[model samples]
Target chain A: MTRAELLADDPLWLILIKAVVLLLIGPLMTMFMVIFERKVVAWMQHRPGPNRVGPWGLLQSIADAIKLPFKEQIIPTTADRKVYFLAPIVSVIPSFLAFSVIPFGPQVSIFGEQTVLQLVDLPVGALVILACSSLGVYGIVLAGWASGSAYPLLGGLRSAAQVISYEIAMGLSIVGVILYSHSLSTGDIVDAQRDGWYFYLLIPSFVIYLISMVGETNRAPFDLPEAESELVGGFHTEYSSMKFAMFFLAEYTNMVIVSMFATTLFLGGYMAPWPISLIGDNYLNTGWWPVLWFMGKTMLLLFVFVWLRGTLPRMRYDQFMRLGWKVLVPVSLVWIVVIAGIRAFRNEPNISTSQILVFGGVALLVLIAVAMLIPDKRARAEDEYLVPVTGGGHPVPPLDLEVPKPPKRRSLSEAKVARKPAAVPAGQSTSDTPDKESE
Target chain B: MSAVLAAAAAEVSTGEAIAFWVLGPVALAGALGMIFARNAVHSALWLVLTMLSLGVMYMVQQAPFLGFVQIIVYTGAVMMLFLFVLMLVGRDSSDSVVEVLRGQRLWATVLGIGIAGLIVGAVSRSLTDVPVENLQQQNAGGANVNNLGKSIFTEYLFPFELTSALLITAAMGAMVLGYLNRHEKGMKRTQKELVEARFRGEYERPSPLPGPGVFATANSVATPALLPDGSVAPESLSRLIDSTASETFSDEIKSVAGTEPGPDAHALTPSTKDTSTTDTKNTEDTEETR
Candidate 1:
């Protein structure tokens, strides 16, 4: 459908149907995301995953969904009743709301009326998604706070720091897309990329967007807020049954939302890939085919999410913060400047690819020069702290920690020195000889 | 009269009208709660509610961008920082109890009432002039993101740029002030000294074992002693009883603490035997908590 037809008036029933579908997608995708993540990660680890629940474990997530609601709800006695109860609901609602603005396909006929394949699409479509994500953090922070526990509180604090740092990069990275597309609306972005996907042209922005999306969704490596190893269950440590399930569902829905956003912004939403579009004079790009392509792209990105989780270890919190603030943000800012310069230069009649190449080469050379001049303290520090791991000897964990150490083997002479001889009476004691004398 | 009657078309749907009424009051109540809540986290939660209400209000006004910005920036990021501070600093009642400024509460009440009265009076007088039709046309039509962007760039460019500069200056000022206080604890140490101090065994390492080590992983915080064969041996130095499942005396349980288990260790009895053991356990638990 053309851009003009996006906001065409729809019957109330159609709106309701669209809304219902939009809402259902979140829970359904969440269920699918859970099983998908487990299965994919299991495959990566060379293990069979949950195949017991149903045919090839297809019904596992569904079974989990059925089980979660029936589980006994637990509320900590120390928790503030109102806020504790509201946190998960608060978290789940924004996740659903954020999905509202993401367009799945072009205008289509629905019950005799022509409309978009998805729910409402705002002018500030991407921004609405960002807002919803930001709002979702409250559920987590509140959950941690109302639990009146320590680890959950730490998890909450980590989340606050993480989202704030990553969001700047996330927001700035999208700016490049807006500048290229000349519109904030998602549909406009897709239409703008009909000829070329932004993933190829805006490579740096795409890379940054990908990184930020991982961080934004709190997926593995960047999932410090819910890092099980560090904080037990993190912010949901005190949550149980349905409340915990809400948090769990919210996380997966976020994964889907972010994946879809990445697809829409960089991968060309709903548009079929190259060669596929070449089929039947571009029949693959039209009609209901676009929706299929949209889902296909999003699921592919979601697989990447699971792939990263299975392959990478969680980052140290400081490392994560540094990556977001020091690396991603500054790099994107410079790249954005370069992109803006390129865009403005392209508007000129005489600009050529050769001229842009010259500009890029010069920029690269300067960056290298600057990097060569800067002192690397971290490298030196790493060298200083490095220790040889020899003959089962290892660095000691803190006294409070419970690291196991094996007993040392002793030579014959050393064993004699180490073993204390049992206390021997100078003469036979009464108790020692009593049993024999009595017999 | 006809013009007024015909203007009903300009109004939002009945559902939206009801939502507005409900959300408005909820927002107001949230703001009030933020002011009067007992705990700091509760206050932050109330502030969140207020921010969400304001976001909905912006959406009602046909400005989705502003609404989203309200939710994303104010409710999402800002209040999260507030909650973080509250959670990290802990539930210190002294934050509310000890008034740093004398007569602060009285002056706050006065100023608050005066501002509320002024706002109510001003809004009551100006409410009639707001054209409802323009808002309806804006919402029902295409995205107003372009219009908002155009106005900000063209009409209010200077103010926008000026505000950003102002924010930068404030941030710089804060950093400078914070940096000035860094040396208040002591003279600044050399990098070498800082590194040495941080890495020193006493400062960096934990001093004593929490208990006889029953578990260890390379990634875990706990460190245990090892045999020549690289198998863990319990230290048998713990003052408190280890109650881990591995310490249970059942067939499935091994003596993780290196203590020989008695026959009665696996069973729970409610007579003299259980009570005497429970007495000792209660003492140990009390000591542990302390």
Candidate 2:
């Protein structure tokens, strides 16, 4: 059957089943992502993770979820009650909505009806994911704001700024993928990569996307929003119980979604690996087998997330933003141009391999020459510019400690003269008179 | 007008229309409560209620994204910042109303009414001109993320980028403004210190000793005259003068005794005193001759 026929053939009941499956998969995947991230990070660090729950601590996430609602709910006195209540729901829903566009597996027969293994697909499915992720920022911003505390507000602001910054790079990074596939639909993009994954061809875009995804999801190393060492749980500082749990669930779900998206866009979604694909069509790329391939690739990316969290310390907010705007966005833009050039050349049927080689060699030469010629821009000297001391008038002397001179002391007689006279004077004694006479 | 009205009526649900009828006044009341509540915190709560009602209105209009964003951004973040600032500054509830119009309540009211009139006029004009066709189209598919994305990246790309620049500018502006306010406070403290230093430099010391002849006259007045038989008076006039002079000197010394001398100054004081005594004698002799 054609793609359209396969998509349209799903009846109402089948669609309902798909939707339920998609919805259930989100929370379940998020739970596993949480457990897997912990276990993998623990393994990397030579320690045991979540071994107490059901086998290998897999049930720990479930227990935590169950316990969440029973925990105390705290409504800050200064918080806007309605907004506080709505923020977590705002955060979690967008993540689920973004996941809805993700295609899990190939067309499968469910209840004797052939349908694609997805809740729904849009022609602009890739853009929908981006939009949903963008919308997720409102949750973090609101969560920070509704906490009605300094740290949370700062965290919210940082998250908002971080999202806005990284999102540009994230979107720009995907431009190469879109150019290569000649399609914005996630499924179409995945299908176009049947010959070769974009990760092999557009390595820079993949790297940029990988880094941006970490920042976009506010995960560790890029997790300035919830840097407990700095922001004290970041935007959701005051959120408690199920609300807090929802934020946690939203974060993990986002990680899963982004990793899944990465797999689909760059690493060929649900496609059998190189070795597995070579084995033959009978063994792999089948109904249930493709799901395993997709999950395996996505889990590898999730492991990268865990590895980053274990290895790298969280970046300062400004540093995170600088990397996004200064490094990632610029590099992604250049990479997009190069990818576009390659696509344009490839579209020419008469283009020879030598011509491609010549173009590649020239590009490499120009990159090397530019790298060699460009001067390194170091941070400006400490005294180059005076930072206007805010809130107080004097420019805050940069934190180089210079001991101040001690205050000069006055003579005792001079100090005594400065004191105000007492209201009542002591009566003069005859002894005082004789002492005065002797003086 | 009738056709447009009918179209609008068709778009709204009967249940929603009922909800609108009920909630419209309730929302207005909440807005009024926000304006009139004595406590700033209470007013913020009322504003939250107003925002919630507005969210419901958006939901009724089938714009769930806008409804949620409104609640999450404005009511959540913006209002929270307002409350945080208010709390941090410690604005007194009782004083807030009085402070709002310290000198020109009338002008404030007039300006407020004028702005309200302008908004009402603009909104009414825009409402009449809104393309009903677009509303129908928007209502059909709902405001899904895909449509929003397409519109943003394609048609509104420039505006979207501009909005991002505006946000960056705002963040930087807030940091600068906060920094400046803190700097001004520090300047004020330094100014106070300068003023105190000037006051200290202007301080003058009063003289402690009178001339030698004046002391002698004072002593003679305090002493009794010698008896004609060459016996001393029961009370000595010289003694009286000396005692009075010494008592006055001690009182003057006590009055000026509080200056804590430096260690070096304390060490040199006795030597300095001997030199000053010799100088005082020479000065006294010159003054007596003059």
User: What TM-scores do the predictions have?
Assistant: 0.76, 0.59
Whole-model lDDT per candidate = 0.78, 0.73
* Model 1 Cα lDDT, one tens digit per residue, B1-290: 11211233655656567768999999999999999998887787788888889888777656667888888888877777777777778875547587899999999999999999999988987888755555444434454666677778999999999999999999999888877544345877655444444434435432333333445344232334454454444553332435333334433322332222366653565464434444444444554455
True contacts kept of each: 0.56, 0.00
State the lDDT of candidate 2 residue by residue for A166-269, as single tens digits.
87788888888877786666777888998899998889989999999999999889888888998778898899999999998899888989999999999999
lDDT tens string, model 2, B242-277?
A: 555753574354335432222455565566544443
The best candidate in terms of DockQ: 1
| Number of the top-ranking candidate, with lDDT as the measure | 1
As a whole number from 0 to 100, the lDDT of residue B69 in candidate 2 is 59
Q: What local lDDT score does residue A163 receive in model 2, on the 0 to 100 scale?
A: 79
- Could you tell me which 10 consecutive residues in candidate 1 chain B have the lowest summed lDDT? B1-10
What is candidate 1's DockQ? 0.26
- Return the TM-score for candidate 1, rounded to 2 decimals: 0.76
Q: Give the per-residue lDDT digits (tens) of candidate 1, residues A369-424.
A: 99999987764335554333335644333235565776676789987765644344
